[model samples]
Target: MKVLIVGGAARLGPHVIRALEGEHTLRVTDIVPVETQHEFQQVDIASPAEVHGAAEGIDAIVNCSVEREGRRRAAFDVNSRGCYNMMRAAVSHGISRVINTGPHFTIQGNTYTTFDYEINPDVPPHPSTNPYALSKGVGQEICKVFTENHDVHVLTYLFYEFRDHNNPTLRGDHPFAISWRDAAEAIRLGLEVDLATLPSRCEAFNIHADLPHQRFSNEKNKRLLGFTPQDRLEAMWQRR
Candidate 1:
C-alpha cells in the first residue's frame, strides 16, 4: 500500500515510519522539510490545496499532525482545520481509509476523569474546554462526519502517555500510557485492517499497554484491529 503521513516531522512520525517502512511505500509530509528516504512533501495540512496535492496517488493517509500549544487561532487552524483538509483530500482523491491520531483526552474529559475503571472510547466526548483537547475533539468529529457522508472509513487512535520501549522509563503512573513501539504497531494495524470488518464507518480506539489499573479499556482495539500491545510496562506498577 502507498501511504501518506501528514506531520511527518513530529515526535510520533518517525516511530510510525519505522513501523511501516519496507512493507509499504510512504510519502511523508510536514510543514517543515523532512529528511527521509521515502518520498517527502512539504505540506502544511491547514491548506486544502497542499493537503490534496500531497495525497495524490496515495492509497491511505495517517494523520499524525497536532498543534498542542500556541495561540487559539493557530491551535484551531492546525488541529481542527487540518483535519478538515485531510478528510476533504481523502474524498477528492477517492481514498477510503484514513488513520487519525490524537490524545485520549479527546474522549475522556472532565466527566469521565472522575471514574476509575473500564472507560471506553465509545463514550461521549467532554474535552472540558481545554484548548488542545477541544480542538482535537473537533477534529475527531470532522473525521466522523466525513465518514458518515462519504465512502471513507476513518479509524481514530487516541493515546495518552508514550514511553520508550528500549529504556522503558516510567515517568508517571498514568494508567493510559503505552510504549512508542506499541503505539506505532497499533497505527500499523489500523492502517491495514479491512474496512468491511469495522462496525461503523468511523470508529475510535483507545491505544495503550495492558496496564493493571483498568482505568481504560483496549478490548475494542483488540477485537477490531487485532491489536495486542506487546509492552506490558510492568515496571511502572511492579515492586522490585
Candidate 2:
C-alpha cells in the first residue's frame, strides 16, 4: 500500500511512520519540511488544492494532522475543513480506505467522564465546547457523512494519553493511556482490515493499552480490527 500521512512531521506521525515503514511505501507531508527516506511533500491540509495534490497516486490516507491549541479559525481550518478536504480528495481519486485519528474526547466528553465504567466509543459525542474537542468532533462527523454518501470507508481511531514503551518508569494516571507502539499498531490494523468485515462504512474505536480501569472499552478494536495491545502497561497501576 502507498500511504499518504498528513501532518507527518508532528508528534504522533513518526510513530505511525515507523510502524508502517518497511511494510508499505509512504508519502509523508506536513506544513514544514520532513527529513525522511520516504517521499515527502509540503502540504498544509487546510488547503483543498494542496491536500488533493498530496492525495494523488496514494492508495490510502492516514490523517495524523491536528490543531490542538490555536485560535478558532486555525482550529477549524485544520481539524474541520482539513477533514473535508481530505474526503473530497479521496472521492475525486476513487480512494476507498482512509484512517482518521483524533483525541478520545471527540467521542467521549463531559457526559461520559462522570461515569465510572464501560465508557465505550459507540456513545453519542458531547464534546462540550472545548475548542480542540469540538473541532475534532466536527471532523469525525464529516468523515461519517462522506462514508454515508460515497464509497469511502473511514476508520477513526480515538486516543487519549500516549506512553513511550521504552520509558518503563513513566506512568500516566489517565485510564485511556496507551503505549505509542500500540497506538500505531491500531492505525495499521485500521488500514489493513477488509472493508466488508466492518459493520458500517464508518466506525470509531477507542485505542488504548490493556488497563484495569474500566472507564473505556477496547472491545470494538479487538473484535473488529483484531487489535491486541503488545504493551499491557500493568506497571503503571501495579504497586511495587
Candidate 3:
C-alpha cells in the first residue's frame, strides 16, 4: 500500500510511521517540512487543490493534520474544510481508503462524567457549543457524506488523552489515556482492515488504552478493526 500521511512528522506522525514501516510504502505531507527519510510534499489540507494534487496515485490517506487549539477561524478552516477536501480528493482520485483522526469529545462530553459509562462510537456527538468541537463535528459529517455518496472506506479514530507510557501515572482512574504504542497499533489496524468486512462505509471508533472505563467502550472498535490494545495503564505503572 502506498500511504500518504497528512501532517506527517507532527506529534504522533513518527509513531505511526514506525508502526507502518516495512509493511507499506509511504509518503508524507504537511504545511511544514518533514524531517524524516520518507518522501514529503508541502501541502495545506485546507486547500482542495493542494490535497488533490498530492493525493494522486495514493492508495490511502491518513489525516492527522489538526489546527492549533484556540484559533477559532483556523480550526474551522483547517479541520472542517480540510476533512472535506481529503474525502473529495479521494473520491476524485479513486482512492477508496482513508483514516481520519478525531477527538473523543466528538462522542463524549468535554466535561468528564463522574460515573463510569460506556460510549459506542455510533452514539451521536454532543459537542460543547464551541468552535473546536463544532468544527470537528462538522468534519465527521463530511466523512459520512463522502463515504455514503461515493464508494470509499473511511476510518475515523477518535483518540483520548495520549502520552508516552514511561512510568505511567493515573489521574485517579480517569479512564482516558492512549499510550504511544497503543495509538500506533490502532493506526496500523486502520491502515490494514479489510473494507469488505466493515459494517459501514464510514465508521468512527473510540481508541484508547484498555482501561476499564465506565464511560467508554471500545468493544465495537475491537470487533471492527481486529484491535486488542496492548497498553494497560495500571499494568505498566505497576511494572515501573
Candidate 4:
C-alpha cells in the first residue's frame, strides 16, 4: 500500500515512518523537512489549494500535525478543518483510507478537571473543557461526519502519553501511557483491517501500550483489529 504521512517531520512522526518503512511505499509532506531522504512535499494543510495539489497518487493519508503553542485558531484550523480538507482530497484522489491522529484527552478530562477516565471507541466522548481537548473531540466528530455523509473510510487512534524516542522513560504509573512502537503497531493494524463490516463506514480505536493500569479500554480495538502490541513499559525500561 502507498501511504502518505502529513506533518511527517514532527517528533512523533518518525515512529510511524519507521514502522511503515519497507512494508509500504511511503510519501511524506510537511511545511518543513527535518531530513532529506524521503519524498518531501511542503504543504499547508489548512489551505484547500495546497491539500488538493498534494492529494495526487496517494493511497491514504495520516495526519500528524499539532498546532503551535498559543495558536488556538491555527490548532482548530489544522486539526479540525485540516482533517476535513484531507478527507476532501482523499475523495478526489480515490484514496482508500484516512487515518487521523487523535489525542488521548479526546476521552480523558482536561487539565483543569481532576476526573481520571478511560474511554473505549464504543463509549461516547467526554472531554475536559479545554480548547485543545475540545478541538480534538470535534475533530473526531468531523471525521465521523465525513465518513457517514461522504462514504469515506476514516480511522481514528486515540493516543495518550507518548514516550521519548531518543532516550525513552516512564515518569509515573499512568494508565494512558503508550510507547511509540505500540502506537505505530495499532495504526498498522487499523490500516490492515477489513473495513466492510464497520458500522459507520468509519472506525475509531483507542491506541495505547499494555500498561499495568489502563485508563482506556482496548478490548474493542483488539477484537476489531487483532492488535496485541509487542512492547511494554517495564521491558522498555529494562532495555534503557
**Which scores better on lDDT, 1 or 4?**
1
Ranking by lDDT: 2, 1, 3, 4
In model 2, the runs with Cα more than 4 Å from the true position are none
Tens digit of lDDT per residue, candidate 1, span 70-115?
A: 5788788989999999999999999999999999888788788786
Report the poorest 10 consecutive residues by lDDT, candidate 3: 107-116
How many residue pairs collide in each prediction?
Answer: 0, 0, 3, 1
User: TM-scores for all candidates?
Assistant: 0.97, 0.98, 0.92, 0.88
The residue pairs that clash in candidate 3, if any, are 116-214, 117-214, 117-215
lDDT of each: 0.91, 0.91, 0.82, 0.74
Question: What is the per-residue lDDT of model 2 for residues 93-166, given as tens digits with 9 covering 90 to 100?
Answer: 98999999999899888888886488888888778578899999999999999999999999999988889878
Give lDDT tens digits, candidate 4, residues 1-240: 888888887666888888888688878888775574667788888888788778788887888876645578977887777887888888888886888887766655554125444456656567655667777777778788877777579888877677754455445666666778788877777677887856667777777777666456777777888988666666443444
Model 2: which ten-residue window has the lowest total lDDT?
A: 165-174
Tell me which of candidates 2 and 4 scores higher on lDDT: 2
- Candidate 4 stretches with Cα past 4 Å from truth are 110-118, 164-169, 235-240
Instruction: For residues 1-240, write the lDDT of model 3, one tens digit per residue.
Output: 999899886677888888887798888899998887888899988888999998989999998887758889899887899999999999999999999987777556554343337777777666555677788878988899898899998888888677676744544455667788788889888888899999899888988877765478888768988898876777533444
lDDT of 3 at 193: 88
